[model samples]
Target: MSNQKTSDILISEVGPRDRLQSVSTTMPTAHKKQWIRDLAAAGLREIEVGSFVSHKLLPQMADTGEIVAFARTLPGVFVTALAPNLHGAQDAFQAGVQKITIPVSVSEPHSLANVNKTHAQMFEQVRQIIACRNAHYPAVLVEAGLSTVFGCTIQGVVEEDDVLRMAHTMAELGVDEVGLADTVGYATPLQVHRLFTRLKHDLGELAGSAHFHNTRGQGLANVLTALDAGVTTFDASLGGIGGCPYAPGASGNIVTEDLVYLLESMGLRTGVSIEKLLVARETLKQGLPNEPLYGFIPDAGVGKNFHYAGEKA
Candidate 1:
């Protein structure tokens, strides 16, 4: 059975949205719904089900509205979606997402390439999005995910000062939270620690989740660093199956199963069932049969003496 206990950490699963958008194969709406159900059943309270992007631009996410509708039916699950602009945010609000994450790239080049907007324009869109949310869906939460905060594949060597400035701008625009994303997987542990520490010190309650990619095999190390820096929320994928579609050479998010095991073994309660998470991974594989899945715990299996954080040893 899934754990009924509350968690000390929040693992926001992003496989359905982030992973699907990057892949060429479009998972059917039914399969997407089933995958979400399985993930929630494994005790993932927050799930980024899909994005509110154009079908022509991202055909894989064409059924996002339907996915959101289905995910809303699951009890105790917080449904979230990515919305790159005012139009997408409006669609997401209408679709009933509990939270909307807007990617605000810290790198100017990345911002232009990802959403075809400058920093000022992106901030303006965020203002409009917040205005629309306040005027209509006051209950919906808005988060500005600061993409390429670590470094950019296009721009290269994004400054920490610039990232802090963008995050502060988003906060000033009325976002509920601001998260740092290693969009191209260029983050190191020391860099992650220093930035996140500064972010927490600066933003306090507004400092949000850590989104890391395993492109350089530093994802887990970065996670540990962020956790030590007082970050309790994290973003991971079911099978490490996500990367920035717009960021070249970026591949794989930190795997959900491994992340759960890491936290649980460290005596941090994530409230996720590793066995059930593995089951959810199977559901993911069934949806994208040809797609390659990555994770260590899935291959190695848990140790004989393994136990969940809150469980009696």
Candidate 2:
């Protein structure tokens, strides 16, 4: 079964959308465009360019449409965005995002705080969004993300049944896939293994990507669990720049650099060049000057004995 699973890993870059939304200062559109371009040049096939939230609240994502337009020009790169509702989905479709991800928290308190909607209400929103996408953008993939699947900062201890139901609900609503997210970064490896295994049992082909946070230092461990359960796609941020700003210290996603290094050393093909990924981190630091980046691989540097694919040892 492991051999039958995907031999190549798909790293879906989320820095432009997630990282910028977290920082105290807003990144300029030109910088964000260059960041996106540099990441694509580093061989990231899929990227979550931006979110379609209110500019009044998230000024950083105000240029989501423009970023999406710019990302589309890069051949072989699939542009993705986060849309909370039908309106966002419409905007995403107009901007030509190839995929749209909508997050619905399992914890009611988290859900209300994040989107001001209940899980049920959010499910309806996803359904409506899916309908609209099917009518106008049939090729566009709709990803329903179940946030706070393990625990929540606001409510705490989300039930596994809620996650299963959310996955089933989204799949029933015509979503292309359903993802599990560690929004507050409280997932353990055991929990990761259990949830994803159970979720796959319930959701089948609808089991989507893994969106883990490095809040409590268990980000990569959670990814390992997901891999053991047959997950091939992952969401990561360059330099680990983006995470739940509300949850301090939980400031990075699983670093794209580190995850790639882990996968590469373990014999999985990620199709990313570590040198290019590291070079792109410079653009990240430049974009968010005051933001402190996190990643062990970047600090430690690649070992002398390390050999990436297509590179001689």
Total colliding residue pairs, candidate 2: 0
Which candidate's lDDT is highest?
1
Off by over 4 Å in 2: 1-7, 245-250, 309-313
Model 1: per-residue Cα lDDT over 153-252, one tens digit each: 8999999999999988988999999999999999999999999999999999999999999999999999999999999999999999898778999899
Instruction: Please write out the lDDT profile of model 2 over residues 186-279, one tens digit for every residue.
Output: 8999999999999888878888889999888999999998999989889999988676544434566889999999988877888888889888
lDDT of each: 0.93, 0.85
Segments in model 1 whose C-alpha atoms lie over 4 Å from true places: 1-5
Worst 10 residues of 1 by lDDT: 1-10
Clashing pairs in 2: none
